[model samples]
Target: MRAPLPLDAVLGLASDLIRAPSQGGIDTPVAVLEVGARALGALGLAPRLLDDENGQPVALMAEIEGGKPGPTWVLNACIDTAPAGDRGAWSLDPFAGVVKDGWLWGRGSADSKIAVASFCHLAAELAKSKDSWHGKLIVLFDADEHTGRFGGIKRFIKERRDIGGVMVGYPENDIVNIGARGFWRAKIEVYGTAQHSGAVSPVPKNATVKLARLIQAIDAVTPPPPPEGAPFPLPPKLTVTGVEGGSGFAMVPNAASLNLDFRLTPAFQAPVAQKLIEGIVAKLDAEIPSERPTKIAALESWGAYKLPADSQLGTALVAGASLAAGRPVPGEVCGPSNIGNYLADLGIPATCGFGVTCKGVHGADERIEIASIPLVWDAYGHALEKLLIG
Candidate 1:
């Protein structure tokens, strides 16, 4: 009943959010939430800041009570994004939030500052015309989605136990992301005697060499190939992320750590995956003899989660997507994310991908089509309305 969210306002808010720069774990999300809170409050919704005991705000949640009681819907959009790496790679300032040529280009513009903007206005419109709707809507702006630590969404999950249906505003090209591949955060350390580079050159006993050996061992590990004709875009496996060692040319590295990520599929659960990582470390420790041997530690591990029950909320969302995208959109899609698994583990019907189509999400010159913004926004709102009416 309220006027459809103003187009100009949505664009302006997206630009402001992109400029704010809440880069996941690096920047505090408090500033982003504060801005969101002010906007929500001005629209006559109660924007409450939820924080940990240590006084760190997880995010701002604004609630709207509809005309009648129905299912509660959690509308989530992350305030944080992956750090904008190598600023020079972007043609425009990564934080510029430039809207032109029918596109919004910037670091977070596509990935989700757009959703933040759209969802904000959606909440306001719903609140203004609560009499025209049923059920409750919670607009949530969360943190640490990019870094995947004990972040905003996780903390919020813990704080709010009684949840209904959840819809995540992550980019999926107008398609719903039904399942997300799970992964493990691990570090492999290869230790050796530290000495001058010249002294260690003869025997190659430095940590870097040990690191190479460790990599070779891990590379030798072959997980079973994806089952014939898998639907997943990428198969699950170990991916070496970082090499931490070698201070300078003058010194021989004593300890080099390799940050490894293990992506899991339905075939491999946590227990099986955990043992596989341990076996790699054990094999290297026994094969190579050194007082300071190779060791692998799991910083974190979570198995892939497939929804046990068929989700009616998911059906409603897919239908909504059809309305928004002007075509039937499939709800089943695969992507890399840990949050959906986390939500599923808690027995919540959760899924990501309800935003503008994105390109170069974690790379340079990231962007999204400006037209897709309102499209997904309309779909999300319509879906919520349908679910409550049901």
Candidate 2:
């Protein structure tokens, strides 16, 4: 149908990005994003860096307007990467951007840098063939994602109210993630009477002991399953992510805390989850009387969401993917919450987790299949054709 995507050009740009260190938390180096911006610039598009509240550059954006008016869509990927762990464990240099054995190797190779490169090339192709489609195509490269703050995306959503839909390139070619499970996070503080270790008469209430009891109580919880016809079948899950407090063994600790994370489902929402956890804490408070009550404070919460079966964005993407695969590529819900969840909260529709086959994401020796690039490129290009032209 359409000419093959600029594979060699995409790989070259992706290699440049992988070699640049743009780890989150640390200020993302501007030079790294400039590599992609320069490519977009060469395509006769104006690319610019977007900044966070504190004036740190956090994203790059380039727009292409079609010959006629239509809904604007965004193609998004993150430029920032998770911290490279234990550099010595890698068989190849983490930042070498090595292309070997039909794979592109390095940090951010799969988790997203390649998508950034591919999207840039795709936008260039669209620019050259403006009559083939309508509506605007914006290439958004988030520079502050891995930090978990999502500052870049937040800014974009706030500023661009005209955005019709977004496609997040999250590195998975087989299944198109149309939605994701939400999450509720909190911290619990358990109080106890601090006392000397030698005092046997009172049998001091050890905070660590109380914390362990709370952990057991929480671990015992079995969240209800999703509704029979729920879009996402994944059930709610609770995890005690961290436990803290207590020092030297000589003295009984007075207080302890543990972090709680609940993966939510449609049937079990954030408020329901909070109530369940609070009920457990209340039961523990009454069952095991302590110096002070156990306190639970919510840290963050996001409700689960699913795109309608007939959603224009989802339908087009699924069709494109199936076309590329020569078989069915089901639109599935992802277990982990992603940028799409945030967009849902804002009343914007988005699709995530569709791209090249990746290996060792967020792990050592991360890479993406070089051959899989065309499939991804074709899938999205075809989706754009459907949405913008028809």
Best by TM-score: 2
Q: What is the per-residue lDDT of model 1 for residues 275-328, given as tens digits with 9 covering 90 to 100?
A: 887877777777766777677687876557554336777888888888878899
Tens digit per residue, CA lDDT, model 2, 273-326: 999989998988898888689999999888888899989999999999999889
**Local accuracy by lDDT, each model:** 0.77, 0.89
Residue pairs in collision within model 1: none
Please list all clashing residue pairs in model 2, or write none if there are none.
none
What lDDT does candidate 2 reach at residue 296? 92
> Which parts of model 1 are misplaced by more than 4 Å?
1-5, 128-134, 200-204, 228-234
Per-candidate clash tally:
0, 0
- Whose lDDT is greatest here? 2
* Candidate 1: 10-residue stretch with minimal lDDT: 301-310
In model 2, which runs have C-alpha deviations exceeding 4 angstroms? Answer: 196-203
The TM-scores, one per candidate, come to 0.91, 0.95
